[model samples]
Structure formats: structure tokens, C-alpha cells
Target: MRKALPVLLLSTALLAGCAVGPDYRAPALDLPEQWPEHVLLSAEARADWQQWWRQFEDPHLDALVARAVDDNLELRLQLARIQEARARLGLARAEQLPSVSAQAEAARERTPGAASPLGQSSTDNLFSLAGVLDYELDLWGRLAREREASEALLEQSLFAHDAVRLNVIADVVATYFDLRSAQRQLRITEATAASREETFRLEQLRFDVGESDELALRQAQSELESTLAQLPSQRERVRVLEGALGLLVGMTPAELMAELDYGDTDLEAIALPDGVPAVLPSELLARRPDIRSAEAGLIAANAGIGVAEASRLPRFNLGGLLGSAAGDAGDLFTSAAGTWGLSATVMGPLFDFGRSASRIETAEALAEQAEVQYRATVAQAFNEVRNALVTYEASGERVEAIRRQVTAFERTLELAEVRYREGFVGFIELLDAQRALLAAELALSEAMRDRLTATATLFKALGGGWQVEG
Candidate 1:
């Protein structure tokens, strides 16, 4: 029996090296070699892309992004999930090793006088100390497959955390840009309101002195009131944007209620990035965390098929016990009181109405779902990059066009004012010129905001400067 046990163990060890089911291979994808011809790209170093928000050259924005990375609730939740996956991986690894336990016992019993050969009852004590060992032999590599799946899940968790982190950073930057835009709009409205009020006062004085008619005076007052009416809505927009920015920067409810004080930063002053990185479409698969996370999930599902397949085969377990037994506790360790045991167990599904086969089918179906999801994630990533590139380029062009429009309106307003004062044009013409200039200036402000926000979106779509480590 002893010789046969060693031979069986050696044979099982050899079989353990051969696993059941399919191995994992990365899915192949056909990707473009270059971006569309209309998309602008730059062959620039990506070192600065890691903290892409710093390109705006605003210290306050840099600080806010840093705070969001450290304190965002969503990021904290992902970190906790990572820890849980790590623990599960540890448990899976432990299953591949042996388990040991120690036990000690003491017992005393008295036999009835009638049951004993001697006519008197006697008390006896039994003392024992034992150590037991149990190990599952991976004859079909089931434990190894389980460990592989657990490792992939851990990778999935890590990449998922990175995905959330990328999103949080992007949101903070985009919200900051929006807040600045709203502030700029509010300032434009306020300045226009003040100018109109001055114009109204001058018209009132001219009407009283008979230089301007009541019609001109009433028109000036109406324009002034119209500008005044926009003040409240613009101010409210600024407040709402401020609240959004505060939340993105991870401010508590109390802190937001107290009003976040982002220093006076002008929207126009924010520098536009010169160009975006020129990376091939295939390279995007490596840079994006969401794509990597999806692939990890697929790999895990692939490994699960092996686990299910191995479950239909036999499982071999080896167990052993070494101990000492004696009538007295002091004599438990003596040579005459030694005890030992060895056992081998084989368990497999004999007949359960195809239960094992059903499990294998379920695993296969889940694997197919994961593969489809992976492909969808990759497709979505490419679509976003394409749209962001187009939007960013178009926004820049729009800003330039609006700037030229503002310049032309400013000149027209100046000419109208001069002609009206010289009695060559009516006050109605001057009013139209003033209204056009104000509208153009407001549009220019909004266009500038959109350009900056578009740049941020492009950066996010390109995976925000994250790279896979070697």
C-alpha cells in the first residue's frame, strides 16, 4: 500500500500540469493606422499629458484637480473594491495549498460494576494530541484555473479604478471651464447694463433740454431695462456653475453652501493647447482604462470555462493524521502510544441529470457576453475620439469667426454714435448698433468658453495621457 501511494502521487503530479478547457488569447481588432485627414494631430511628447489640466497654466485649477483625485467619493469606492478583489485572489491562491490543523482531547469514563469483569467500577482517562493535514491534488488543474480567474478579476478591479479616476479628473476640468465661462458671461452682462444706464441718463437730460424727443428717451430707457433684466439670469447661471465646480473638486456640502472662492480668473486668459497627441487608433486600445478593464473581464470569463470543465472530472484529495494516545496525559507522547493514519478520496459527479454539463454551458454563455461587451467598449472609445476631434477643431474656428464679428460690431457702434451726435443719423440707428455690438460681445464670450471646454473633451477622449506600465 505504501509503494502504491507514492506511485499514485507521482502520477497525479504529472497530470496536474495538463489543464482542461481553452487558454486565453487577446481578441484581435482591426483598427485604423491614422486619424481622419481633417483631424489635426501633433507629434508631441506626452509627458505633460498626465496632468493635462496644468496646460491651462492656472494654479487654482491644478490645486482643484489634485484635491478631486485625493478626496472624490467615487474614487474612494473603487479603491475599496480593489481591496476586496485582492482578498479574493488571496483566497483562491490558498486553495492550491495544503491545510493543517492541531487538536488535543482528554476524556474520563467510569464503567458500571456489573459490566466490568472486576466487581467494582473503575475510572479511566484518555488523553490524545493530533495534527491533521489535508490537500486537494489538482489532477485536472481545477484549482490553478480558479487562481487564474481570480487574478484576472483583480486586474479588472485595478483597471476599473483607473477608469473612474480618469472620468473624475476630466469632469473636474470640464466643470472648471464651465464655471469660468458663466462668470465671463455675467461680467459682460454687468458691463453692458452699466453702459446702457449711462446712455439712458444722457438721453433723459437731452429730452429735458429739448435736444432729444420723448421717443428717443423712451427707447434708451427700454434698452437699459432690457439689459438690466438679463442681470439676474446671468448671475443665477454663475451661481449654479459655481456649485457644480465645487462638487467636482470634492467639496463637502457645507463647504459648497459657504461658497467656493475660486479667484478671479478670466476665460480668455486660459491658454489653448497648441495641439493634441498624434497616436494611431490601435495605440488607443492600450491607453484607455475602460477598454483594458473590459478585456480583463473577458479573460476572467475565459478562465471560468476551464473551471467549469474541470468540475465535471474527478477531484483527488490526500489526507493524513499523526498523533499520540494514552491512558494518562503524561504518557501521551510515548512510543507505545503513537498513532497515524493516511487516506485518499476521489469525488466526481457520477449522475446528476447533466448538472455538470449545464454549468459548462452557463460558463460558455457568460464568456460570449464578455467578448461582445469588450468589442462594444472599443467601438465606443473610437467614436468618442472622432467626435471630440471634430468638435475641438470646429470650436476653434468658431471662436475666431466670433472675434472678427465682435470687432466689426464695435466699429459700427462707434460710427453710429458719431453720426447720431452730428444729427446725420437717428437715435434708432444708434440703438440698433449698440444692441448688435452687445450681442456680438456676449457671443464671443460664450464661444471662447466652448473652445476651452472642447479642448478638455478632446483630451479626455484620447484617454487623458494615461499609459500602460511595462
Candidate 2:
């Protein structure tokens, strides 16, 4: 009967308990089957998910992105959050197990009166040792709910870290492309300035010889001055872009310049895939990172309701104490001195009036807010993907037009130089042709830069190559 009493108490404790909080189930929402607009997400457009940055085929770019992922400040913060959540999970799980404690105590006293109740003349000494353990049975699943919330938070932190990494890669690639474009434009500006100077000199000579009017000379001078003004501005752009890139890759501009040379690299046109995998709206629920985080939070909030509901029910804690009390230290382990006791306790909040009720309401409201936020995030993601596709396609079209314009300008410059050599056209005419050619060449450089940026933007809008590891 002694053995059965503990078991019977446990059975009665579980039987009397009931969970008060609402159970968590994902809220349903109406979502589209897939993106309505066409995006050029072909099978070929999908690079190796493990190393998406390598698709650009720039070794330096790959290295920069790799370094940023490992060293970025924002990513490090998310990692710390993951560690915190793991610790919290450990704390929640520990609540389900016994809490044990040990104790050693000693006391001495003297009584000096034999005639009075408090005046005994005897000396007494005592020494005692004991251990205790306490645990709460999770009959209502309150502990389980708390543990689930912590685990969900841990997953959310991991996804948030991945999102930070993708943004870092995008920033590095965008900055590198900007630097290249600025350098190319600077080269064009210098060529134009030289052509303008030569034209001004020729016009001055013609005016002195009385072969050209002052108005004609002035027109030539005006063109030269305008082109010259552009050189300083273009040079400033190069300096600014260099500085911006320095901050991104964690280097000074002088250091970066030492490693990079003015070499032209071609930006190939990106071809979009014919048919992208049809991801339905329901799939979007699980695919997007921010949405996943929101959903995790919603789950956590729902678990919070359980936590509040469990508060209304009586809380049960079971504990046991074991050890020995003896007159001498060496007798502490003897069966004669050994002692132990067990207890079961329960307490309930008779009335917080409505605090528990308010908590449950607050949790439900937060969960609703998370659901709405998730849907909004999904809609915005679709818009971003479609917008990037349109921009990329337009950039592709611009590259073709710029290519033809550059070709025509090149031919025009060649003919104008020949005419000046034959003494049929003034040196100013040749200079005009050269200046126009430089502008066209720079325009082509800009168009190619735009094409690469557009493709990178599109890749980013597609959630930056999610690994689905979760």
C-alpha cells in the first residue's frame, strides 16, 4: 500500500487537470496558385544552389561574397540569437526533470539549569546531511508548449541569418559592378577631353590665318570647354564609387586599386528559362524566409495562449528528500541514521480577476497580426519578382540598341579622320566625330552594366537561392 500511494497520487493529479488554453493550428488564408505574371526563371537560369554567387563567373566576386558571409556584422548578430534560443530551449526542457540539492549542517548548544525547563546543564552536538529533488509533472502539456515555442524561435533565427547572407552577396556584386562602370566612363571622359583640346587649337590657328570666322572659333571653343567640364565630374564619380566599394569589401580604396587593373570584362546577356517551376501560393507560405519567421512567431504566440491557460489550473510539484542525520560524522551513512521524506503539493491562482483572460486575448491578437503580416509579405514578394523580370527584359533590349549605335559611331569617326587628312574637312570636324564616338562607347559600357545588375536583382527577388534545408 505504501508503494501504491505515490502512484495513486500521481494518477489522481493527472486526472484532475485540464488545459485551459486554446490549441494552436495554422490559420488558413486564400492565396494564389502561383505567380500570375511571366518571369524568365528557366531551368538553365537556376545555378547550383550551393554556390549561387559562382554563376557570375568572377573569382574575385566569389571571394568577396564568401568573406562577407563569414564576417559580416549582421550575420554574426543572428548567430548569437540562435545561441540564445538554444539556451532558452535547454531551460524549458530542464523544467520537466527533477531539481536536486544537497545539504550538510551542524549545531551545538549548552543548557545550564536542571531545575528549570530551560536550565539543563548538559551539552549536546548534532550533525546532519541531506539531499532533495523536485519536479513538476507536465500533465497539461504546459512545459511542452513552452519548449515548442523556443524551438520555433531557433528555426526563425537560422532563416533570418540566411537572409542576411543573401543581402550581403547582393551588395558586394552591385558595388563591384558600379566601380567597373565608373572606371569605364572615366576613360571615355579623358578621350573626349583630348579630342576637344585638339579641335580648339586647330580653330585658333584657322582664325589667326584669317581662314575661319571668330564665330566659328568661338563655337569650337564652347564645345571644348563643355567637354572639359565633364572630365572633372566623371573623375569624381570614379573616386566616389571606389570609396563605396571599399566599405563593402572591408578594404581601403588604395588597397583595392592595387589588386584591380583597368581590364574590360564582357557582361553576357542573361536568358530567362522558358518554364519556371510552378510554385503555388500555398507553397509560398513555406518558401519565403520572412513569412516562415512570421509563421514561427504565430506558432509561438499560440503556444503562449497555452502557457496562460495552464496558469488557471492548479500547478503540481513533487519532491523527495533523502540523506542521514547522525551524532558523529562517520555514522552519517549508517542505516540507523538514514532518513527520507516525500511530498506532493499544488497551488492555484484563485483570482487574478482577468489577468489570465487578458493574456490569452493578447496572444490571440498577436497570432492574428502575424498571419496578416505573412500574407502581405507574400504579395510583395510576387510584385518584386515580376518587376525585376520586366526590368531585365528591357535592359536586354537596350543592350542590342546600344551595340548598333556604337558600331555606327565607330564608322563615322573613321570616315571623318580620313576626310581631315585629305584636306576636305577641318580638324574640328574630325574632333566632333571622335567626341560622339566616345559618348556612344560609354553608353554601351553603361548598358552592359545595367544588364548584369538587372539579372542580379532578379535572382535576389527569387529569395536568393533558398536551400530548403529547413
Candidate 3:
């Protein structure tokens, strides 16, 4: 027995090294060296990108983002999923170690010996207490592969949680910008309405004094009413945006119904970033949570192939039981009642029609799918970054152009007002100028909002401060 023990141990050790299936490696990507735009790239800026919203220097915005990260429902859901993945990883790791359990029992049995020559009956009691141990030898590394897959899945969950967090923060910032824009537009509309009201009042006085015709008075009234008509819709838009922002910050229904406290922030007052990074390194894409999550999924799938392959081979298990059995409960621990056992089991698929082979093929196909998905995710990430950069640049240009237009239109309105008062131009001309100025002002406000939101999006596309651990 002693001679056989070493041979069995050596054989088990050798077989344990023969793990089946393919190993995993990260796929290579083709990436650009730098962004298309010409701007300064500062390492300090990159380091602080996680708090990019704070660049606006708005304390309200910073607080909103912090609250959303803490309480957003979607982010909380991702955290729950992470917990589940961690538990699954624990289960997988446990599979590699021995399982120990304790059992205790007491039973009574009665025997009838009526068929015996003596014709007697008897009653007996049996008691047992045992400790059982079961362990599976990883002859083909099946358990190890399963554990690897679980670990990868846990990593995927972690990255997914970060992805959700980044998205929530971006959403909060963009929605806040929208709300502020709407409020600004509402203010502008109110101011325009007041100006037209005064014009109508003066025209009414002129008509009553027989200095202006009814046509002129009616035109003035029409303009005033038209401007007033916009007030309700503009106010509604402001309210709707408030509700939306409230929800993004994880407000309850009651809180959404109430007025949101923005602490006197104006869209125009929000600061604009000077320029985006000129040279975004391709390797920085690795910091993107979605990309990392996709690669983790690929790794899990790759490990799954090994698990399937190992399933086609035999599984070896060793079991042992150390127990005490006694006819009397009081004597259960006596040496005379001691009992022990050892067992070795080999379980393999003798014939399963092609089930095991089919599993392997399925696993391989999934691995291929994961690889394709990983590549696709990486491609999409780069595309977003490129598009965000372009949009951000274009939005800035639009703001500049609109600002110029607003300035020119403001001057034109002033000149038309003077010309109309001096009786050198018709009221129609003045009315046209007023309308043009209002349109330009509103457009400028919208353009500003777009630019700010675009910056937030660019930050999001750049993965918003997520960094890989060493």
C-alpha cells in the first residue's frame, strides 16, 4: 500500500498539469496617433478629466453629479449585478477545494423472526456520527478554467458598473445645461414681450390722436400678441426641463413636482473649456470601461472553451469518511465502534451521442462572437471620440458666428427704431428688425447650450476619468 501511494500521488500530479483548451490574449487594434484637431494636450488636464464638470466652476453642477453617482437607480442596479458576479466567482473558486460535511443519525429497527425455528422478535438501536470529505482532482483543469471564467466575469461586472456611472454623470451635466438654456430662453422671451407691449401702447395713442392709421395700429398689436403667445410655451419648456434634471439627479416624484433649486446659475455664465486635447493617444482607449468590459467578456468566453473541452474527458474524485457506529448511543465514541472508509471515483462520458462535442462547438462559437463584439466595441469607441471632437469644434465655431450675428442684429434694431421715430422708415421695417434680433438672440442662446453639452459628450467619449489598475 505504501509503495502504491507514491505512484498514485505522482500520477495525479502529472495528470493535473495536462489542462485542456485554448488560452486567452487581448486582441490587437489599429488606432490613430493623434486627433485631427490642433490643440494643446496637457497631462494635468488628462489627470483631472474625471471631474471635468467642475471645469465649469459651478458648485451646483458638481453637487448634482456627486448625488447622481451616489443614488442613481441605474448605477445602483449595476452595483447589484457586480455583487452577484462576485458571489459566482466565490462559487467557482470553491469548486477547486475539498468539501467537508458532518452527519449524525440515530435509528431504531425491529426484526421479526417468525420464520425462524425459535420464532422470536427483536428490536435494535443504531447510532452513527461521521465527518465526510470529498475532493475532485483537476486532471484536465476543468475547475481551474471555470474559476478563470468566473474571474473574468467579475471583472466585466466591475467595468460595467463604471460605464454606468460615467454615463449617469454625463447625463446629469447635459440635462443641467438644457435646463439652464430653457430658463435663459424664457427670460429673453419675457423681455421681448415687454418691448412689443410698449410699442403697441404708443401706436394705440397715436391712432387715437389721429396721427396713425388703423392699419399701423393693428400691425403693432399683432406683433405684441405674437410675442406674448410664446411665453406659455417657453415657460412649459422650462418646467419640463426642470423635471428632467430632477430625475437625472435621482429625485423622487414629489421632488420632481416641486421647483428644483439651481442656486442662480446662468447658461451664459458657465465657462467654456479653451480647447480639447490635440494628441489623444490610442492606448488611452483602454481606459474606456465599455471597451474593457467587452474584452473581459471575450476572456470569459475564451475560458469557457477550455471548460467545454475538459468536459469531454474524465473527472476524478477522492472521498473519505471517518465515523463511529454503535448499537448503543452511549457507546458511539468507543474505539470498538469506530469506522472509516476511502473511495476513488472515475466518471466519464462513455457514450452521449455527441452532446460533449456539441458543447465544445457552442463554446467555440461564443468565443468567436465575443471576439467580434470586442473589436466592434473598440471601433465604436474610437468613432465616438472622433465624432465628439468634430462636433465640439463645430459647435464652438457656431457659437462664435452667432455671437457676431447677434451683435450686428442688435445694431440694426437700434437703427430701425431711430429711423421709424424720425418718420424716415415704415413701421414694417422696424418690426422686421425687432423680429430678426429676437431670432438671433435665441439662436445664440441655443448655440451656447449646444457647445456646453458637446463638451460634456466629448468628455464622456474620452471615458471620463476611468483608469485601469496596474
Off by over 4 Å in 1: 38-44, 109-123, 466-470
**What is the per-residue lDDT of model 2 for residues 1-470, given as tens digits with 9 covering 90 to 100?**
68986786779667545554666677766665666566444344444544555667776667777767776677778889989988998998897677899988998877678755866577767788999888887667688778777878777787777666777778877777777777777777777778677877987998899988897688778887887888788888877776666566555456666654323543332232233333444655666676677777777777777876776677778789898998788788899998999887887888888987897788778767866776677678777777877877788799899999889988998898789657798757776787778778888878878877876776666666634332
Q: Write the per-residue lDDT of candidate 1 for residues 135-177, one digit (tens) a residue.
A: 9998887899999999999999999998999899888888888
**Which has the greatest lDDT?**
1
Candidate lDDT (C-alpha), each: 0.89, 0.73, 0.88
Tell me each candidate's TM-score.
0.95, 0.84, 0.95
How many residue pairs collide in each prediction?
A: 0, 5, 0
Ranking by lDDT: 1, 3, 2
Candidate scoring better on lDDT of 1 and 3: 1
Please provide, for model 3 over 82-187, each residue's C-alpha lDDT reduced to its tens digit, 9 standing for 90 to 100: 9999999999999999999999999998778985467888888999999999999999999999999999999999999999998999999998998889889889
In terms of lDDT, the poorest run of 10 residues in model 2 is 269-278
User: How much is 250 displaced in model 1, in angstroms?
Assistant: 1.5
